[model samples]
Target: MSGRLQMALSSNMAGESRNLGNGHNTNAASPLKIFGHAKSKIRQVFKNIDEYVTESDRFLSGVPAEERIVDAMQIENVKAYRGKIRGIIDVLNRDHMKVAFFGRTSNGKSTVINAMLRDKILPSGIGHTTICFVCVEGTDEPEGYLLQEGSDDRKQIGDVQKLGSALSSTKASEDSMIRINWPKDKCNLLKDDVILVDSPGIDVHPNTDVWIDKFCMDADVFVLVSNAESTLMQTEKNFFHKVSERLSKPNIFILNNRWDASASEPEYAEQVKRQHLERDIDFLANELKVCSKTEAEDRVFFVSAKEALISRSPHTSTPTSVLAEGYQARLFEFADFERKFEECISKSAVKTKFEQHTVRGKSISSELMAVLDNVFERAIHMKAEKYSTRKEHADKLDYVDRQLDMMTKDIKSKIYEMTEEVERTVSSALNEEIRRLSLLVDEFDRPFLPDRVNMDNYKKGLHAYVEKSLGRNLQSRCSKALTITVEEESRQMTEKMVALLPEEQKQNTLNFLPRRDFEIAYKLDCRNLCADFHEDLEFRFSYGITALVNRFMGPKQASMILGRGFVQNIPRSMPMTPQTPTNEAHRTMGSDDNEVLLALLATFSSLYSRTTVGALAVTGLVAKAAGWRILALSGAIYGLLYLYERLLWTNKAKERKFKHQYVKYASSKLKLIVDLTGANCSHQVQQELSTTFTQLCQQVDLSKADLQEEIKKLNKEIGKLEEIGAQSKSLRNKASYIDSELNSFILTYLKQKD
Candidate 1:
C-alpha cells in the first residue's frame, strides 16, 4: 500500500479526540482535565483518518490510472503506490453483498436454492421447477402474492394447488411472476440480509422465455446450477450467452446434485465428478462446485417436499431412524452450502466496488482527454474550414437572389397577358353573335297603315249607316270593320320578324334559350300594348286582330318558328277566367278578345327574355374564366421558383452552421489548454504536465457527450417535421379538388353563353 493509505489506516486505529472551549471556570487545575482533553483529541484524530482512508480507497479502486509513465524513474514509485492503495481499499468494503441465481430448466437450480434456504419453498421435478419468478426475502410471513402488470393490486397465493387452476382460468401463462415473502418467524434462518430471487425456469415454454430473460438481466449475481447427470446442455449454453451480454459483473455457482446416487461406486463417481467440473468450468469460467442437498454441509439441508408432507401423519409406523438419516443428510449439506454462499456474496460485492472505482476513474480521465482533443483541437480546425465554406455559400445565395428577382418579373408579365387574352376572346365572340341576330330581326319594316279615320269617329259613322240601313245589326257591322283592319296589321308584323333571322341561326338560338325566359319576355310586350287602349275597346280590337292574323298568317309563321321549337306550344284558345261564375249562362263576347290579346303579348315577352338571358350568361362566363386563368398561372410560377431557390441555397446554410459549431468547440478547448499551461515550459516539467493532461482529458469527454446529445435532438426534430409535411400534402390535395370543381362550373357557364 502507498504511504498515504498506510498512514490513514494507522491513524484510524489510534483513536479520535474532541475539544470544548472554556469561558471562565477551570476548577483550580483539576486532574480530570489532563486525561479528558488528551483522550478527546485522540478520538477526533482517529475519526478524521478513517474518513480519509475510506474516501481515498473509493477513488483509487473506481478509477483506472496511467499504465506507463514516460519517465522510467517515476513509474515504479508512483504507479505502484496508487495501485496498492486502490486494491486495499477495494477489499475492505466488500463484506456485504447480494447474489442472483439463474439457469436453464431441469438444471438443479431450484435444488441448490432449496439447499441454501434449508427449506423447500420451490417445487422440484422434471418439466419445470419454477413456473413464475419469485423474490424471496427474509420476512415474518411465509406468504406469497401475485403482482399484476400496470396495477398495484396484489392477490394472495392462498393455496399452491389452486394456483394452476386460477391461472388457467385467467389464461395467464406459467411464466407469470409470483413473489414469496418468508415468514418473520423464519427470518432467523436467512439472517434478514440476503435477497434471493427464484426466477421462472428458463426453456420451460417458448412463451415464458421473455420473463426468464428479464430476470437474468436484473439479477446482481448469477448462480448457474447444472445437474451432475448432465453438465452444460445446449439450452444452458444459450442462456449463458444472453446473461453474458447484459450483465457487467456475474458470479457463477455450480451445483452437483444427487450425490446419493453415486454412493455405491465412489471411485467411478469421483472420476465422473471431476470430468463434469472440468466441462462446466470450460463453459462458465470461475464457477464454484456445490454438492446436492442430500450430501452438502449441515446448514444447507433439503427435504423431499412430497415425502415430508405425506409422512407428517402418525397413522403408519415408519422407522424413525430411516427418516432421521434422511433429515440428517439434508442438514449436513447446509454447512458447506452456507459458507459457499457467503463467499460468493462477499466476492460479488468486492467485484462490484472494484468495477465502480474503475468506472469513475476512467470517466474522469476520458472526459479530460476528449475536451482537449475533440473540443479544442477540432474546434480550431473546423473554424478555418467553416470560413472557406461560408464564403462559397454566400456566393450561391447571391445567385439565387438574382434568379428570384428575374422570376418574379417574368411571372407577372405572363399572368397579365393570359388574363387579357382570355377576356377578349370570350367577350368579342358573344357580343358579335348577339348583335348579328338583333340586326337581322330589325331589318324587316312595319306594315304601312292605310289612311283611315280615327277608330272612335269611324265607329260612330258606321253605326249611323248601319242603323239607317239595318237597325238591329249595327253591332255586328262594327265588329266586321274592326276585324279586317286588325288582321291586316297583324299579318305585316309576323312576316317581318320571321324574315329577320336566318333559318339555321334561328333554330339554334331557339333550341338554346330556356322556356322560362321566353314566357317572361312575351308577357311583358303584350302587357304594354294591351294597357294603352280602353279595356273594352282594346279587347274588341285585340280579339279581332288575333283571329284574323291566325287565319291568314298564323299557320305559316307557327310552322316556320315551331320547326326551330321551344319546349311548349302556344294555345290557340284562351283559358277561361277563374272569376267567372260557374252558374252564369251568358257572358260578354269581349272576354274572348281580352284573352286573345293577353296570349299574343305573353308570347312576345317570352322570346325576348330568352335572348337577353342567353347574352348575359355568355358574358359572365367569359369574364370569370379570364380571372381564374391568370391566378392559376401566377401561383404555379411562384411555387416552382420558390422550390428551386430552396433546393440550391438552403442546404448550404445547414452545412455552414455545422461547421461553425465544430470550430467553436475546438477553439474553446485549445484556449483552455493554453491557459492552464502558460506559453513557455521546460522539458523536465513532469509533475505539472501530468496534472494538466489529466484535467484536459476530463474536459474533452464532457464536451463530446454534450455535442452528441445536441445532434440527437436535432435529428429527432427533423423527423417530426417531415412527418407533419407528409400529412399536410394529403389535406392540400383535397382542397385543390374542391377549387378545381368551382373553377370548372364557372368556365362551363361562360362557354355555353358564348
Candidate 2:
C-alpha cells in the first residue's frame, strides 16, 4: 500500500516498493539476471539429485535386494520427491502469474478482460454471463483447451469465445475450466509474467465464493470494478468484506469504472466526477483497510470498460468507434488503469515467485538429505557385525531366535496376569456388596406387609423405591470399583507392553519382522467401559423387578397396593363358588348348629340392613324385657357378625392367623427381589471381566511367523550378508557426501535471497 502509481499512462517506469524487513528488498539490485541465475542453479541441483537417485536404484536392484532388508515403500517416497522437484523447475521456467478480476454483478469484470486482451472473448450481457471462473492463461501459441473437473482428457478449442457456454449454465454439472493459449503478444500486461482470470460476480452464486477462495487462492492481484457513475454501493462493500478474509488488502486494485457515463449531464461533469472519485477513495481507505487515503488514490482508477472495448475501429487511426461525445477523454482513465496494474503486479511478479520456488527447493533438498543419511546409518548398522565362517553366523542366528521366543513368552504371561488381577479385584468386591444388599431386604418388606392397603399400589411403589436404592448402591460401589480396577490394570498392561523386551532385542526383531512399533499393538479398547457399566446395571435391575412384581400381585390390586388399600376381598379372577367342606375345622364349624346360626344371622342382617337403628332399638327393648340371659345372647350374636365382616373369613379362620400370612408372603417376595438383584450384578461383573480379558489378549498378542522357514533362508543369506554389508557401507558414504553438498548449496542459494 503505497503511492507508487504516479504518472500512470505516461511512461514505463519501475516504481520502488517498500523494503521488506529482515535485510530483504522487494526491489533488490542484482547484476546477474535474476531468472537466468535461478534457472541455472535449479538445473544443476536437479542433475545432482538425478544422479544420486540412479545410484540408489542400482544398489536396490542387486541380489538380496534392499526390499528384503528394509521397507520398499521408502524408495517410492523418494521417487515422488524427485518428481516434485522437476515440477517446480518447470513452473519456474514458465513463470505464469495470476491476476483475478472481482466485483458485484454487471460491474464490468469481463469487459475489463476483453479490453485488456483487445478481443471479445468473455460473454458479457444484461444478466449474469460469466458464471464460473474463466482462467485465461498466456500460452506460447494461439490455442485454447477446455478441461472439466474430474475429466481425464482436455478437449481442443479454436476460440476463447466458446468457453462461456461450457462454464456457465442452469443445468447441473461439475466444475469447468478454460485455459486460453493466448499468443504472448495478445496483450501488453500478459506479455511476460501474468495470466488474467474473469470470475463470476462476487455474490451471484453460492458456490462462487468457495471456488474463488479454494481454487483461486493463488491469484497474485485482485481488481475490484465499481460503477463510477455513482459512489461505491453498500452491496460491493459487503461483498469485499467477506472477500478480505482470504485476500490481502495491499494486493487489491479499486477500479471506478464507467466514469464517461456522466457525459449526459455535462453542465458540471468535472465536479461530479471529482465528487465520485473522492467518495470512493475515502470508502476504500476506511472500510477496506487499504493503508491510507494516498494509497487508495494511487490504486483507484476512473475508467469506461465498455467505451475502452468499443473504441477500437478498423477505419480510424485513433482507437475510437460508436460512442458518446467526450468518450475518448474518459478512455484515458482505462489506459491509466492498465499502466497502474502493470506497476503494481508485473514489477513484483518475478521476485515473489522466485522466493516461493527457492523456499520449496530448500525444503525438498533438506528432506532428501535426511532420507539418505538414515539409509546410510542403516547400512553402517548392518556392517558392524561380521562372520569369518558360516558356523559362527548360524550360532548367532540361533542365539537371536531363542532370545525372541523367550521375550514373546514373557509378554504373553504378563498379559494373562493383568487380566486375572483385574477379574479378582471386581469379583471379590461384587460378592461383598451382594451380601450387604441382602441385609436391607427387611426394611423393603415393610410397605408390602401393610394392612388395609391397595395390594396393587403398594407393590408398584415398593418396586420403584427398592430398584432406585439398589441401582444407586451398584453404580457407586460396583461400577465405580470395576472402572477404576480396569483402568489401572489396563495402564499396567500398556506399560509392560511398552517395555516388553530388552530394547535392542525388540528392535532387532522389528527390523526383521513386519510388526514395527510395539506401542501401536497396545491400544486400549476400554473407551466406553464406564458408560456400558452404568447402562447394564440399570437395565438388568429393571428387568428383574418386573418379573418379581408380576408373581405377587394382579393389575388392579397392585395399582392400589401403594395407596394403603389392603386386600378387601379375594382376587376377582379366582372362582367365587363355595366348596364342600373337606378339612376337619371347616366341617365341624359348618355342622347343623352352625348352619342354623348362619341362617338366623342372615335373616336378621337382611331385615336390619335397610333399618339398622330401628332394629337395634327393638332388640334392646326385647333384651330388657327377657332379662340378662336374652341380652347376653344378643351381644354374642352381634360380636360374631362384626368379626366375620371385618376379617372377610369364614368361621374356620381367625383375624390374627390371616395377618401372619401377609407378613410371611411379603417377606418371601422381598427376599426374592434381593436375590434377583444380586444375581444381575454378578452377571454384569462376569461380562465386564470377560471383556477386559479379551481386550488384554488382543492387545498383548504374542503371535509370530514360523521362524523355521526363515532359519533355512538365514543359512543361505548369512554368508553373503558380510560381503554385501562391506560394499553397502562404502556406497553409503558416497551418497552421504553428495547429499551434504546438495544441502549446503541449497542453503547458500536461499540465504543469498534472504
Candidate 3:
C-alpha cells in the first residue's frame, strides 16, 4: 500500500481547516467548491423548469378534445421533454468534478491516485490489479464502503486490506464499474466533490471508445501516468486522442511517475527529461489540440509516486533525509500537479457539465412559450368566429319575423276582399238563372201526366233539375275565384316559410304542409224547398186570354205580386169546361199575357226552336165508351177538340205560369243563403292558409331557438378559453423568469476567476 502526497508544513498552516474532508474548511476559496455551488444552483433551475413542464402537461390534458389547440402528439412530445428534464435533474443532483487516469500496465496509475488520496485506497502492484473501472468518491460516513455496478448491497471497507479483498472477489466485466466511497477525513480531493476514476491499463483493453464513452464522457480532467524511464507510448497517446475526440478540449495532465529510477542513468537523465517534456507538450497542444503549448508546459510533471507516498504516510518509519535521490523535488512536483489539477478540473467541470443543462432549460422554456402563444391565438380566432356566426343567426331570425308579419296582414286583407267578391258573383249568377226559369223548366224532360202519382214525381224531378242547374252555374263561376286566391296565397306563404327553414329541414317541412285539393260544396236543397208547388193539369176552355186572366187573378192580392201561395190544388185527371168571365178582366189578362209572352219569347226562342211540341188528338176511352156510330163520332170529335185546346194552353200558359212561380220561390231561397255559402267558402280558404302559415311560423321559431342555444354554448366555451389563455400567459411569464435566472447564475459561477 502507498501513502498520500505530502504537502509543505507551511502550506498546511496557511489556511484554517475544518472537518469536511481532509480538514478542508467551507470558507476555502477553492475552484472545486465553487463548482459545487454552481451545480446546486443549476439543479434548482432545472427543477423549476421541470415543474413548469408538468403544469403545462396538466393544462393540456384538462382541455376538451375539440377545443384543445395542441394535438395529442404534441402534448406527448411535451411530456417527453418533461422526462428529459427530469433525467437532467437527476444527473445534476449527483454531479461532481471527475478525473480519470489512463495508462499502460505497471505504470503506477493506481499508485498515483493513492498518493493523491493520502492513503492506499486502490491496489497497485507490478501485475494487473484493476480489472475494471473503479471510481472513488468521498462519503460523510466515518468508514468507507464499496458499491458494485447494478448492485444495491454495500461492502464495508475498514482498511485497505478489506477494500482490496472486496475488489478481487467481485466478478465484473472490463466495462463495468465498482464505486468505492471513502471517508472524507482521509482525502481532501474526495472531500471537495472530486471523483477519481481508475481504469484497466489501455494496453490490456482494445475497447478504448467504449471505455471513454462510459467512464470519461463526463470526466473534467484526464491524467496520463507514464514511465519516467521511457517516452510516451503509442497506446497512452491513442487513448487521449480518442478522449479528445469525444470531449471538446478535455483537460489533460501528464504525470511521469517513478522518476527516482532515473538516478541509475544519471548521465542521460537531463536529455530524457527534456525529450519527454517536449513530446508531451506536442501531444496536448499539437496532436490532440486540447490545450495550448504554454498551458501544456505546466501540465507535464515528473514524479515518483512511491517516494511521494512514503513522505506523506504517517505509518512509514523512513525519514525524508535518508530517502532516494531527488525525492524532495519529486514530491514537490507531485504537489504542483495536484494544485493545477484542482483548478483545471473545477473550471472544466463547470463549463462542460452545467453550461449544457442551462442551455437546454432555456430552449425548453422558449419552445413551450411558443406553443402557448399559438394556443392563445387559436382560441381568440375561434371566439371571433363564434361571435360572427351568432350575429348572422340573430339577423336571420329578425328578417323572418318581419316577413311573417307582413305576409299575415296582406293575406288577411286579400281573403276578406275575395269573400265579398265570391258573394257578389254567386248573387249575379242566381239572378240570371231565375230570369231564364221558363227555359230551364222546359228543359226538364221527365214525364208529366194527368195522374196524381206522375204529377207528384214530376214535380220532384223539376225541383231537382232547376236546383242543380242554378247551383252548378254559381259554383263554376265562384269556385274559380276562391280556389285561385287561396292557392296562390298558400304557395307564397309556403315559399317564404321554406326560405326561413334550415336546408336539412326544408324537405320535411314541405311534406308536412297541407294539400289544397278538396272539393267545395254548396248545399241547395231544391227538392225539399219546392215541395209545395202544384202542377195545374185541369182542362181550360180558353187557349190564351181566359187562362192568362185566371193566372193573374190569384187567391190573394199579395200572392200574385210575391209569387207565394199563388197555386191551389187542381184536379190531376179531371177536365174542366172553360168558365165565361168578365170582359174587363179578360182585357187586363190579355194585356199581361201579351207582355209575358214577349219576354218568354225573347229569352227562350232558341230553346223552343230546338223542341218538338206534340199535341194529343183523341183518347181511346172516349172513342170506345160510345159504340153507336154517330154518338161515337160526336164524342171522339169533342174529346179531340178539348184535348187539343188543353195541350196548347198547358204549354203556353199553365206550364209557363207554374215554372215562373217555382223559379221565383227557388231564387228567393237561394238568394237568402248566398251570403252564408260565400262565407263558408272564405272561412275554408282562410283556415287552410292560416294553418299552413302557422306551422311554418312554428318551424321558424324552433330554428331560432336552436340557434340561440348554440350561441349560448359558444359563449360559455369562449369564457372558458379566455380563462385558460390567461393562465397560460401567466405560466409563460414564470417560465421566462426562471430561464433568465438560470442563465444569470450560469454566467456568474461558470466564469473562470482563478
Pick the TM-score winner.
3
Candidate 2 stretches greater than 4 Å from native: 1-6, 9-80, 83-95, 125-128, 142-179, 188-193, 206-208, 248-250, 262-284, 290-294, 310-332, 346-357, 367-754
Tell me the whole-model lDDT of each prediction, alpha carbons only.
0.40, 0.54, 0.73
| Model 1 per-residue lDDT tens digits across residues 1-754 | 3232244334334431100111111223322232223223323332333333343333223221221111233233334434544553444332223455666766556555554554555555665545555555555445645444344676664433234222333433456554555553443224424567665556665543464465555354566555555555776667656566556535555555554445456567657755775666555543222323322222122223222322332332554345433433322333334444554454344334334433333333333222223222222333344345545545544554464455446534543443344334333432333233223222322232222444334333322432233212222333244234333423332333223333554455335422321000001121221222221211112223234444554766545443443334346665686547644423544655644554544444345346878545643555586776775676578668656655654433433332343233323332333312221111112222233333333333333344445444434433433333343343334334433433343343222322
lDDT of 2 at 434: 40
- Please estimate how well model 1 matches the true structure, expressed as its whole-model Cα lDDT: 0.40
Model 2, 296-377: lDDT tens per residue?
7777777777777676422224445456676645555565566566656643444566556555655655555555445534
Report lDDT (Cα) of residue 179, candidate 2.
Answer: 57
What are the C-alpha RMSDs, in order, of all predicted structures? 39.1, 24.1, 23.2
2 or 3, greater by lDDT: 3
Candidate 1 has a TM-score of 0.30
How many clashes in each candidate? 66, 22, 1
The candidate 1 region of ten consecutive residues with least summed lDDT is 517-526
Candidate 2: minimum summed lDDT over ten consecutive residues — where? 516-525
Ranking under TM-score, best-scoring first? 3, 2, 1
